[model samples]
Target: MSTVLRSIRAAYCTQAVVDWLALEIETARPTQFQWLQRTLADHFGDGKRTYIDSIDADASGATTRFLVRLNDDHCRTVDTVRAALAALDQRHTLVGPALVKLLEVSLDFYPKDDQARAYLPLLVARLQTSLEAAGGTSHRLVGPTKRAEHLDSTDTPDPRRTLYINNKLDPLAWRVYYKITDRDQTLPRDQHRARVEFTLQGVGLHQYGINTVDDLAALDFGDFGHLLHFRQFKPLPDLIANMKPELAQLVQHATRRDRNMISLYPFGLHAYRRYNTGKHAGKPRNGGHPELRKHSTHTTADAELNQLVRNRLHDLTQFFTQNWNEK
Candidate 1:
């Protein structure tokens, strides 16, 4: 399959929606967050609105946060933003059932973008109209008390600066990171760099009957080479098992090298086993049908099997040393 590339931008304040979408797509599930965002954007036309960054629900044990950035021009005073969020919270409590019902209906509708958008405006308008009909006041409960309190006259804010509802635990942070850092632009590039620190744990190979480091040291010669010499041997599984100690050591040493020698393990093993006399032939001569088609209970033990196993181990060791030591 050909590789498909996608470029994404950081969305401020819509972190919850972006995160929900990522999780849903990764797990092959459906989500309502995407629908809500699209619906709001379409109807509201990117209006200045305040959404809760964090909410603690007593009954559901659910915590919902917002990650959104404000447009400079539409930037209301902090007091206004806080008040708007409070109003939104009250609306959420009052319209909880309606919101859930909408989500359920939207879930059943396939081709979400196309179908959901069609009904979204109607839903939003209906919601507002219904609330008013129920005697709820349409008060501007959030945002600055006066329109003059707007921070900037700019109509649009920097789209790259993402606004999130939660202060930490950003689920969509990786997605945003890939977008901002890896995206293509027309401008000349300058060398920029950053560093990240992390920790990793290592495991030993004794779990696979390989006790003591010497058992690995002893197989440094032909024993490792024989494993890869097989023409048709599938070496991945065996190589992984045999080279655990060497790999663990590499991690311990923290080497920075791109070793290509490891490719030989699979290649050599596959090449050597391609023409082996046993399985390639149809006859039952050197074992049963050369394929070792079935284990004959009456047959005597053969030394070739042991040799084959030993050779495999040797090849695995060689692969590790060659690749792991490369600079």
Candidate 2:
């Protein structure tokens, strides 16, 4: 597997000098935001909006936030981020270092094998089930409503496409989704792969000790790696391998269809319940059905998937640290 820090949205809080200059720009030419955005974009890269693609200023002109997309191979470095900030500084002319605020980080994974492809959907389903199991009153699901006073322009998130773990307004919120489809030709045919993405946002970045670009540059795999998990659904043989002799015999004598059904757990249990009570034999007993359930279970994905994430995270960290020690 391979991983990349696909994007980040950070804000540069202007100091007093730039604040006055920004306010002056806003006053003299209320539409300078767009022009400034273009200037900064041009200064940072090819001026084609490929690197520092998004730029904007707040009402007070005290802060400017930009979205940086590390889309190209040459731009995947901490130096790129620093260069982005430097571009902003050169254009804004600040007296001191800009107060950097990280709003979100998107980590994208490209699976090399079929393990992640097979497991990702199941993993998402499990996460959704776990969230639903938490019930409605859970704070993880609830947040302030957006109304007349609290109107904010945000995309209506599609639950089917993205598995959001918590309310977006929470201190820390994240989501996972597959970014590529069969029709997507953004990359080469062999590289046309399952792009599983995990996004982290809000002040949770601070809680995770990611305060600055440098912190992100030095992030450890364990810092945010624990968020990804998988559940392995064992095969039929493994599911029933430990049953007692009589139980195993009862399971063994069952038809291949029934054995296959048993592998699915509770679904198969229903059929066995009827058989154990002699319902099929027209001699059903009152509450005589033996209790049966799936006992064998695994919490972790296969080793291949686990190591894939670890290796990819290492690669991502290496990208940030490659030019890190030089300057």
Candidate 3:
């Protein structure tokens, strides 16, 4: 799988105050907020109107607050953000960098191999299962966000199509989950492309030490790798099928309802040990369930997928470090 730097929001803070209403009527503030908003809307917004969050006009001065959003509609690259900000700086003749305040960023992971098409859609379920099995919470193991809870509330609709983890637009948090596909398409659709997106906003950005474009450019994926912990799980049936008969039987006996449950390695191991020491005590006690040895699922599926994501994050870091002068 490969990752795309799907979306980014960078803000420019300036002391220049201009007439927003007059500019709206094509009067004043040609090179200030109005011009910046229109240019960014046309360039990265698909010509849609950019929404202003607030406008403060007090004795000090007047200022307008808004977001010029960059999402899936635009090119999926950090260069896009760099180009937009650079344009603003040159157009307005600003002395320093423009749009340097990094508000939010989203990175999308999808299958790069044609062979992995079938497996892409299953990631949503796999990630959800992993979260549930891991005590329904996730935390960063490194970075400033270390020990911060990520999985707060999840939206798992009946008949289960998508999974939204901590999916809200409040308190500036991190939302990580999978998107099945576009609305116009159905399952098993074209390319079967599934996306596991990571969106980190204001507070989350600060937690990751991403306060400015320079900070984002200097990001290290190693400090944030633990955020992709969901990649640890593989399909259950495949794990059982490859296990030795003795160990496989223990796994099957462990799961109360469905022996074909998504998780079997750690969960089944506990059950297997209990059976060996208790009811089945008469039989020679088997050593550990042989999953770590015989079952290659852990090393093959889990490790390979996790590495793919980490590699992609590293690639994004490199992209940010590169100089971008064009849109």
Candidate 4:
């Protein structure tokens, strides 16, 4: 069986913070223990048991906890642990108290016993480097005060859908031919290469939110390789079926909203323009110094993806605010 081991050392102002975190983890949806169990079961054979190595909390100062032996055999144990931790961080943002501060988290992997202890120093150094880099807000938001105004002014209410199609003819053909080949026959050294191409097209109709398969189809995949494949391949349905009931519902709702926005391409563009321009005091066409303008133009492409992600996050925040109390 595969396994993952993790150790977390947290420095808190008081023991209260540690206690709160522990309680929060216990109460968390997809509880900490549940996450551990599910993760292990997904990767390893159906083993419901997880062994906790240690849980030490210093009431006088900070708290340190170690979680070892999370059985997941599919991938690198350390990487999986890191992913679980990151997911925990995101969940904390959604449900945790404002007082809880995650000062630092470090993760390491040990495929073999000999490599484990030696990696701690490196992990500490990496943590120190990240701490050193942490300072100040990276950027400030400006421009329109209201969301509707921003959306309207920027001319990006909703963007059009763009499709990216990937037809894996070669792989399918190879599998079909390979099945007929005798075991004694040597496999072909040079297999045919698969052809994958992206197609960008506007959705047929305008939709306020994404909530349906057709709505999701409206998302533009020209810019995002993954999204493009999703549009063409329609993998979400399969994924939803595989996910837990609650998670599947959430994904379905989110996917629909995402696709609806994509159907209105120019509107989405306008929305982003409104967000950026509203956050800052600048003209849509010209604002920054010539050099800054050149730099900003070069950076705008990257910003497109960022804005799309932020839009979705904003929607998610609104969702939680409406559904749950924030306090």
Best by TM-score: 3
**lDDT ranking, high to low:** 3, 2, 4, 1
lDDT of 4: 0.26
- Reference-based lDDT, each prediction: 0.23, 0.39, 0.40, 0.26
Q: Give me the candidate number with maximum lDDT.
A: 3
For model 3, the superposed segments whose C-alpha errors exceed 4 Å read 1-35, 42-52, 55-62, 72-79, 89-119, 131-159, 167-192, 231-251, 254-259, 264-301, 323-327
Candidate 1, superposed: residue stretches over 4 Å from native: 1-63, 94-327
For 1-327, candidate 4 gives per-residue lDDT tens digits of: 001112212210000000001111221332334444454454445444544322343443222333334322221222333344444445432233211111111111112333433333332222211111111111111212322222232232211111111222211100000111122354342311111111112221122232222332233321232221111112456656666899888877876777532222221111112224343445546552212221111111223223333343343333322333423
**lDDT for residue 129 in candidate 4, whole number 0-100:** 16
Candidate 4 stretches with Cα past 4 Å from truth are 1-297, 301-303, 319-327
User: Each model's TM-score, in the order given?
Assistant: 0.15, 0.51, 0.52, 0.17
Worst 10 residues of 3 by lDDT: 14-23
Model 3, range 1-327, lDDT digits (tens) per residue?
122111111111111000011101111222235666666676664664543221343444334333345433332445555676566555544343323222333344345454444444344344443422222223221122233333222322211343344434532323334434443445454334434444455565567776555565576755555554443334446657778999877866765466324332222111112223444344345432221222223323356435555666665455445544323
Clashes of each: 38, 0, 0, 28
| lDDT comparing candidate 3 with the true structure | 0.40
The positional error of residue 74 in candidate 3, measured at the CA in angstroms, is 4.8
Write one digit per residue (lDDT tens) for candidate 2, span 62-128.
3344444434332446576567556655666534333234334344443444554444443333333
Which residue window of length 10 is worst by lDDT in model 1? Answer: 100-109
Displacement of the residue 282 alpha carbon in candidate 1, Å: 88
